[model samples]
Target: MWVCPGEADPELVRAGVALIADERGSVLVDAGQSPSHAREIQAALLAAGLPAPRWLVYTHHHWDHVWGACAWPDVEIVGHASGADLLRAEADRPWSVRYLREEVLRNRRLGPSFRARALAVDSWEELRILPPTRVFTDEVELPTGVLLRHVGGRHAPDSTVVVVPDSEVMLLGDSWYPPPAHLRTPADEPDLALVGRLLDDTIGWYVSSHSAPMTLDDARRAIAG
Candidate 1:
């Protein structure tokens, strides 16, 4: 398993991209924030002598996690059913800078912060919003024994986690975080119980999109406190 670290810039949202590979092929955790960011992941893998990804798995439908689908045209994409539905809604929308800036102004769900994150790209010319090619509900195990689970939380309804058993690493994405203030929702809380159930002896490390990888014990502390 290899991880291409994401940017820490609050205005520029690039979530950590992970690669778990075996003899079968590689499975990528998130597509990334933009074409440039996706290509950066590709370059990082190449530099590390890693195999090209065969499957791209989304942790959720947020722009930072799914916008880089266009960069991996040949790879099969897997996303949660509900998250795919949200992406499908914007599949046809133009992803130009003007459109994004306008969306920031008009869409109640989007705000100035959204504008900063959405537009932090090298180039929007190659931008294309492609929905997932394969959608699953609940949990699915890949041929390589990597597990993906739909554990919705306050951060995003379609939040998913990827578990690589051999590596004993779990990709938490943003599932552990609370909802953004702009979202104006108070209904959901972090599903620590469900998260705890997955953190048995098998898993030793947990990686969240925005933070460095944590030991299993550290993860538990973070969630508890």
Candidate 2:
């Protein structure tokens, strides 16, 4: 329950769960979609029932990973300085009209498949959730002893990539938004090519906002082939 499907995005919304370790309390890599979806993320934390979250981080300002942040219990929210602005906007509007149309169709026809999509778009305007108590430009450390670095100018204005070498895992929000069919599709299409370059240089063992952890070799091959 602690690391199943995050609420950040819906369509192929596979979740990347908590990277639990004995040395440190659980450091939730990212909060999911709306407050409701965040509750879903919390379900996993609840399920773990030990080493409760000491803090939470955001991959970026994307509505899916942020709007749901209000559900967190006033934990320290970490991110690039620009991330809060993005989240503020998210709680102000529904997704683009095109996105909503897709959501309606996916919900009505796609059945259970729409769960992720709904999580990403549902209650967006009403929730207005994201509020990062802490902000940083480049990097920050978690009480659990994980180091999160803000990989700049790759995915979005305030894109963040969280790394915890002790866990030997890195949480990449939508930078590598997994395609519905398991393709290396960039969630931020405009920065797709650029982001790929950053991933090449910085990441090793990567996890998507919605998929399982991917090894460096797998990530490179997914990009090249």
lDDT, each prediction: 0.83, 0.61
Clashes of each: 0, 12
Which regions of candidate 2 deviate over 4 angstroms? Answer: 5-23, 91-126, 176-204
Query: 91, model 1: CA deviation in Å?
Result: 1.8
Query: Each prediction's TM-score against the native?
Result: 0.89, 0.68
Model 1 segments more than 4 A misplaced: 107-109, 184-194
Tens digits of lDDT, candidate 2, 15-41: 454544455456666666556666766
